[model samples]
Target: MATPLWLAGCVAAPKPSVQATLPPAPPPTLAPVEVEPAAPATQPASLFTLITQGPVSAMLSYSEKVRSLNGNELNAELARLGEPGDVPTAQMQTALALAQTRVPADLARAVGLLQRVAANTSAEARPLHPLARMLAARYLEQRRIEDDRDRQVAQLRDAQRRIDQLNDRIEALRAIERSFARPANGAAAAPASNGAKPAP
Candidate 1:
């Protein structure tokens, strides 16, 4: 009925075995560098430049018109020029003066041209255009310069007054010293010995 040890060993099963493996090492990494971009072309004109250019161009055009007319065609020429604005208006007046010398008897026509110049000047001064504003600022600067000159002159005058006072004080001090300098004894009353007192 019982099984033998040799018989039990024959009934048991066998176990399985496994092997291990490793992968190869990887390569190193690197950092990247950056670059900047280029700037754009052609910027737009400024507002001040636009304003100044307008008046400047107007003046040039009006001056050319005045030259073409000279004194003979003042009325029609000025009409074509429209308005001087401010630029060459003064300059045109100078031109008119020069032209006048050449045609003295044509003074009437020259006067007409001058009147046109005056109109431009008045226009420039009124409503206060850029040219007029610039002129006014310059005038203000000139006035400041004159005022500074006056102040410096007044300061110099004050300095002179102080110097005169000091000089007068010095003269007065010299007079007081001169009065006290003389001795009670007269020069003619010297003793028999040189610079010695007489025996009492």
Candidate 2:
């Protein structure tokens, strides 16, 4: 059967086109990273351990040894210091020991040694300088205190002597007063006896 021209034209027209669909793309991969291991925790060093292990260790050790020595050993140590060796450590040890003795002569010697050590500006003596200066200062203060105490003791002795003298003077004055009183009483009795009696 024959159709209309418009309907024939519509049939001859191409059917509606359908578009193809594609799957979604995958995410990009990242590079791997390296991580470092953590370090272990550590405690801080103590002051005692630090002082005992460093350049000044020998001096400190020798000082401690001197401190621990008995009377005989201590005297031996002091006698040893008088020998030919002028070692800094030995000097420090001797000074420390002498300081402990608390004798005026020994303290004076210790102060001299400490001052010598403190005065040395050499690199070898640097470690001992601080300790030496500190010890010297302490000994100086002790000497000053001792001098003040001695002066005070002398003043007290003088004051006591003066007080004793004053007491003696007071006793002498009291004796003199007693003597005068006795003589006055006797004189009064003599006057009374010499005077005429009153009529009854």
Candidate 3:
């Protein structure tokens, strides 16, 4: 009887409580990425500014050399630049022309050179330089004015010729009228001579 009681107590021992396991923590939070903004684009310099202040040609470096050059040196360089068959002749000419205009005395020469450059270009293809364009416009305007003057002169000549023809026609008509009048007068005199008189 004592052994049964002890066995019963051993079998009835309370089952241990089952504790639920917690899930693992999520991955560590990442700091937000700090992306830099893109840089803005820069604008290219103007053709006028480049020609006047910078080198017009890669073959000849005018920017730095021009700064150091005196008036004489600049003049000599301009003479060299003006020669025919120079490499990149158009650009060199433009640069030299721009430089020449800096001197008060040489401004006229610069305008002349610019005029030449402008004349060479057509409406379909124009120079990038502002001075070059202005020069071309001046050339075209001068030509247009000359053409208008010539046209007016031709018109005047034609009008004078027409007036002369009209005057000749009027004189011819007057002569015909005078001739007819004489015939009528002769007929009237002949009627009178034939003794046919108008009854009053």
Candidate 4:
């Protein structure tokens, strides 16, 4: 039997579609940006070290007082120590010496004590606390400069005295020469040793 045109189209197989199902796309990868690190900050000079020392029994009492004492209290403590001229214990020396610097009147004495402490301290041992040898060195340098200046002033004074003496001697010699050149006491002029008369 012959089929109709519409029926033949319906029976024909459908053509395959060009579009295809695809898997989901993954996230894009990004390159990481590099940054330079900042430089470390510089520390200012200070007498105290940041390192904490283990508690020393000898320094325990004084160290506590130094940390908490006011100006008046510090003065009193120093006065008490001054009565017998008691030497400070080694453990408390640095802290006590540093505390002394706070008193204007005690500045020189404090620096001297620090110098002695620095001298006695062994560098290989634990570092000095609350006091640096640099402070002692600076004080000594100032003293040396002052001494040198005093010597220079003395030398300059001596030089000035010698110059004045030489000037006075020169003046005296000039006066003597002038007097010798002039006829004295209205004396008559000396006759010429030669008998020959001077020609006009």
- Candidate with the greatest lDDT versus the true structure: 2
Local accuracy of candidate 3 as per-residue lDDT tens digits, 50-146: 4445433321344445546777777776676565332233443544444433543354444555555545555422433454556446545555666
Q: Would you list the rank order by lDDT, best first?
A: 2, 3, 4, 1
- Kindly report which residue stretches of model 3 are placed more than 4 angstroms away from their true locations once superposed: 1-130, 190-200
TM-scores for all candidates? 0.35, 0.61, 0.35, 0.38
lDDT of 1 by residue, 7-110 (tens): 87688676666555667667666666567333222321222332446544544444454456546577554445454344434434343433423333333443
Select the stronger candidate by TM-score from 2 and 3: 2
Extract clashing residue pairs from model 1.
none
Q: What TM value does model 3 have?
A: 0.35
Each candidate: RMSD: 25.0, 13.6, 17.1, 16.5
Q: Which stretches of candidate 2 lie over 4 Å from their true place?
A: 1-55, 61-73, 190-200
- Residue 86 lDDT in candidate 1: 43
lDDT of candidate model 3 versus the reference: 0.57
Clashing pairs in 3: none
Which 10-residue window in model 3 sums to the lowest lDDT?
38-47
What's the residue-level lDDT of 177 in candidate 1?
Answer: 87
TM-score result, candidate 4: 0.38
Residue 80 alpha-carbon offset, candidate 2, angstroms: 3.7
